[model samples]
Target: MKFEKNTALDFVLNDLFEHYRQHVVAVDRITSALLEAGVVASQADIVNDHIAFRTLGVAHMGIASFEKIFLAHGYRKMDHYHFAAKKLNAYWFKPPSPNYPRIFVSELIVSELSDAAKGVIHRYTDAIVADPVDSLNLGDGQQIADFLQRPLWELPTSQDYNKLLEESEYAAWVIFNRYYLNHYTISIHELKEGYNTLEEFNAFVEGLGIKLNTAGGKIKTSGDRLLRQSSTVSAWNNALFADGITLQIAGSYVEFAERSVLPEFRNIPKSQLSPQQRRDGFEADNADKIFESTYTAQIKDKG
Candidate 1:
């Protein structure tokens, strides 16, 4: 846990964002486009609704280990969600203050995976039998900062990656891109112009030649219609494997979100729909589709 009384909440977020954008290339392109779209007055005006991370359910890692950092910073765990088809368990946290972004973490259920897939995954993850994060000084800013981007295992061969890709795309992704920031969602309702609603904003994104996840039809709305969300397909990157081979795989991407006023608050003026008035939790049906953003649509092993 962070020991300092004045640990500077903003400093932690700023540090995370700086490191995040460096690896998630979509952040740069989309933020720039948002500014150009006049949806925001400036880069500073853009609001991140949340950021998501993917993890494995094996020992020494997963949500239990990752949530400690946030809990230390005053964030509280909120809703818990499970995706049976995806074989994942996840939870979203609310920041101590409204200024910080929410955190969504999902861990794959390794025990449910095919033995072949599990074996290939453990071949690499076994390198860190102990949770590396547990050894770090919780009070150290640099150590907490490094945890997010640090590599936990050696690269797998292209063949193993392809095999994992066949059974569980999430396993392939986590194995190749460990603990990387998966995607950051923009609060489109907070925008000033061109992309205010998820619908229009999605059209605007497609206009820029960015592809959206159509698994559940570009716009995934909550059953109550209080939350609307959309995201671009992940960018493909050429990754090097342990066997001296390179393969193009899906990387991180950007997400757009618009939270309509809850039905109970519908009568209130638009200005009255404050941060809390708008829906604050995620939709399992919506997230189930959003998770597919990381899968290569072709399904064939391009490698």
Candidate 2:
């Protein structure tokens, strides 16, 4: 499907370009570091050539913009797969180098969208070619570097440089996953009685192909032990959710609950606290303290 180059699309394109530029810079930095460290004794030209060969096959704005539009239409991303190119002897056979990281495209599997929504998507695509950027000439690395330097934010910092390589690699995989896979599942159930084991509730989610542990799951409850114990149990009624979707839901829900629910408790002074309430509150506060200490320790270790 084609989409017109509207202002919104242009904004998306700019962001995609900046993202790609940052990724390229990060890769170059890592390669430079490795070369200096004697890990790779190759000349800068060879390294640059390798990077160009790897990334040249990737479409900058076109494929990226299409993936974004597809996501907006409620299509989930899928898993990414990569294959290595084979090396051949110089005389007999020279296998074609793959020239880039194995490229993956996001698919809009029809099950997630309504007919009306699909119609809207089709109309949107008819206005412009999905591959407009394919026809546009992109400049080489030096040109990209000049453009990137124009924006102060585009310059990499020591912290950013340290993290960018790892983050960009992960981000690429994440984008691929969101475009191609069913990363989340939603299940609706009627409450018959009160409640049973968390495992039973989670089993329903698992049956739908959602995995809580993989995505990081949590149970919401007013009860202290119920909350702590639910988190403790390896197998419980915890509904499983996957990475891209479930983490978003859990993060937003927790943040919302903290903002909305905690304020009411502040109205009651410490003097009015019931014995159990005081104990529970104390334990919760202590848990937070411990967590902070451990987190600080880990950060120090990393440094």
Candidate 3:
């Protein structure tokens, strides 16, 4: 269904926001931190601005929230598909934008299977496939290890398990510039010129009050002549948050709220719309504007 920009924005602000309240708090905290740092100007607003305008830390927090919301609805990461794609692409790519991670909720038949039996595998082939996500039935002795494996599977048999996995609908949401930090190489020359060693640079980043999963203790530099790389390896811990899920790929955390349907949409006075409408409206408008600007620049160059 084609929703107006206001309608879509309202859905995100009202529906998605209430549905993921705790997650929003994490996002807000990250945004606040970025503002405190020189990474983002204090006047900038997170909910109504492009994520690219925010710091790497803030962007990761938003992406983490996106993952958790879908996962709470019984979705699982399609690691193979997600990693293989050059960019994050959501299943629902049209109205809401598709530059985020796509997740799938399984519709497997868990009942007749043995204890070690792998449940059915349902893949969300597209964002707007249908009410329920697509399913590939798996019987006993299937040995579909990777797809069915989840922390939830260890739970004792109950209707709750079936309700969690079976009666859920899945949709893919995209996080734009998911690999921003990993993509562009920060010039080591710049770091060396400013600081004597990688530790000094790390200290600077930490001084910004940004927490790093520094379990690896120190950054490691690859000896490659053409491609110099340095990284602080750590797991993204989500244990502190209500949701136990963490991003294993990168060291980051996301806070997630318990799943529930959104409350009824409230009517706003036309005057009240001035602020939120202007803020969210600008984001909706400028998204296309930026794309157009980029396209125009490319076209002029070609001409």
Candidate 4:
């Protein structure tokens, strides 16, 4: 997401990203490494493939409600994706301009969870009788930015959090960290020669001592083999629960994606190729694994 911070949308997006970068240690570590390695002079030099968020599929919330923020900013809703095993639904939004990163928003199918998990979720979200975004003045970027960070529900107790974690990690995540940026993808193909492929980039990142998510593998490739991606394992941070108890819970992570140019566009010169020439939308299989970047299993496995 390259921005000069000149428009309301720019300011709002930058504000949200700044907040995310501060908490997600991997974001800066990767950015600083890129700077020192001369890959980019600053963060803006990296092309953000997209930014993602997690939500709960409950009343007055979820994709229908959360998407209004970006929709109001002139984004157009695109393809829909479903992760059956994960019991999740998502949609990717195309940015109004090429300069902004695409938006990917996903929501957990709360009804599909066990009754105990549903009860724990409702206990926290039943209060949201109306869509929160509806009350906001969407034109006010700062207002929108603040709303994204605001607490929509009370914090969950460790007992409730763990219960949800057992059934659905996505539920556990949203219960505590509502509307926070899940992960921001760095466009790997947009980087210089040596770092443009996931194979080389993964080695670069791993050399920095960063752990990569090995849910499916270090690199999750689409069936067409055009879209390959890898993400860092989430770092645990102290999270305060409702009962004044804190636990080391998984937080946000950073993602790297390599979207190869389409076959139809193979003849185009490298300098003339545009984003549209590359593999566009996301794959359900690839995303299903990427979602596990924060799972305990991924974080615990040393091998």
Candidate 5:
């Protein structure tokens, strides 16, 4: 999340983060705790590992469309990941420079959904016959920022939302919170000693009264055991549906990641080790569980 505010990418990231931080209470909660504990002097000091977004796999949207914004700003598409169980397809974009956090964008496979869920989703998005991002001037950061927050389709009715929630919580989420920054990750390994490992960090976070998503486990580790991640259950907020029904719904959350140095780089001095020397990219198994941070089960499982 720390970047020089001098380019279109910087402005867009900053704008999204500002809106996200304000709504996702845990963002500031963690930042304030870190400040008080002397882990950081300000929010800018915290290194953002990455930011993620969710989109619908409709005709004119999804990663194909959403990715244009970052791709135009010098981000290079890196790897593709598929989640069969969740019916999701995703790609992680490497930042042009290490200073900018990486980007992960995922889209629900609409065609794979049940007819009922597809009908409900299309009722809102079918009208978008043209790709929305195509209409924007990508060079303009403000326009891009506003586009990210803009609603491309009408809000779903409470019944539709609930129905989708039953079939796919991810669907229900995108229907209500389209193109919004789903979650921003904090790079735990970049923190000072005693606070960098997931174990110590999770304890510190829980000690501050924050709840961690326990899907799979409090910590989701990669097969190589080089990447470990944990996240807070999504924040709940009163959401007003198109039908005038208001209900508490899931919003964005915060994620913590620790990328251990690669085995080959073990001999490198800790002080001299660079980000490139650490474990790179993400793991499908790890990300699969991390996606449940917003699920009702995790949100309700206070234990």
Candidate 6:
């Protein structure tokens, strides 16, 4: 935990993350399962590498609107990344101290998508004539917590949902689950024997019958190879549409990240290394497939 000692801010972030875990059913399930299976003794021993969020790339919403909550809590925005294939622009923010998890927020470029995809997204977001986050009080932890799960628009029709899914699984996901927590990563490198590295952890997880996103490969590695990541294919939940029709839709999943020693820090013992000596931020190519952790191609395999 690199978080600076700030009780007030720590409480607020914990409250928000707790609220999120309650809604993201997979979080509770996976964590419990891991503990029950004796992978780790307790939750405190594991570190959350980071958490992710997806946003619509339209007016009155997006990284611009969403980042305020974290920035207000002492997070400083770090690297900016572009995803040409997914039409996303993202940035990762570091915590004031090592205790808090890093934050990654990405917004879709709706204008770059096709008219059909645009129309489906607009149906939900066009109603937000004003930037809602602007009117909210960031100091109020509960308010910010509610805002994360609040529905910005009415539920989309199954048809529109499918249309967006066809064009962009990310679009379909954000449309139904607005401002939802995409996934929280497990810092696998910090774990004990048989789970310290991604390869071992991945094998151990598969032995438990959990499916992983194999889009590029079971492991998505940085070009520098200091950061390796993988995730369970997001579990499908039955979405209750406005029309009362129930259909299985992809929900959030758990991610595993193993950050290796940086080249310059090779001589130092990992325990004695500084935070900067570790792989600091994300890699675009690796994330490209990690993003597919919730796509139709990936979800179909889960089903």
Candidate 4 collision pairs: 1-48
Show where candidate 2 strays beyond 4 Å. Answer: 1-25, 42-95, 98-102, 114-124, 129-303
lDDT of each: 0.81, 0.25, 0.25, 0.92, 0.94, 0.82
Cα deviation of 227, candidate 2, in Å? 39
What TM-scores do the predictions have?
0.91, 0.22, 0.27, 0.98, 0.99, 0.92
Kindly report which residue stretches of model 1 are placed more than 4 angstroms away from their true locations once superposed. 1-9, 298-303
Better of 1 and 6 by lDDT: 6
Model 3 alpha-carbon drift over 4 Å, by segment? 1-5, 13-21, 24-26, 38-117, 120-130, 133-205, 208-303
Sorted by TM-score, highest first, which candidate order results?
5, 4, 6, 1, 3, 2
Better of 4 and 6 by lDDT: 4
Window of ten residues with lowest summed lDDT in model 6: 1-10
As a TM-score, model 5 comes out at 0.99
Select the stronger candidate by lDDT from 5 and 6.
5
Report the lDDT tens digits of candidate 6 across residue range 168-284: 888889989888788888888777677788888888777767888998899998888899999988877889988778889988888999998888789997678666678889998
- By lDDT, the best candidate is 5
Decide which is better by TM-score, 2 or 5: 5
The per-prediction CA RMSD against the true structure, in angstroms, equals 3.5, 25.3, 19.2, 0.9, 0.8, 2.5
Q: Indicate the TM-score of model 1.
A: 0.91
Model 6, which residues run further than 4 Å from truth? 1-12, 23-26, 33-39
Q: Worst lDDT window (10 residues) for model 1? A: 1-10
Please write out the lDDT profile of model 4 over residues 170-283, one tens digit for every residue. 899889999999999999999999999999999999988899999889999999999999999899989999888999999999999999999999999989999989999898
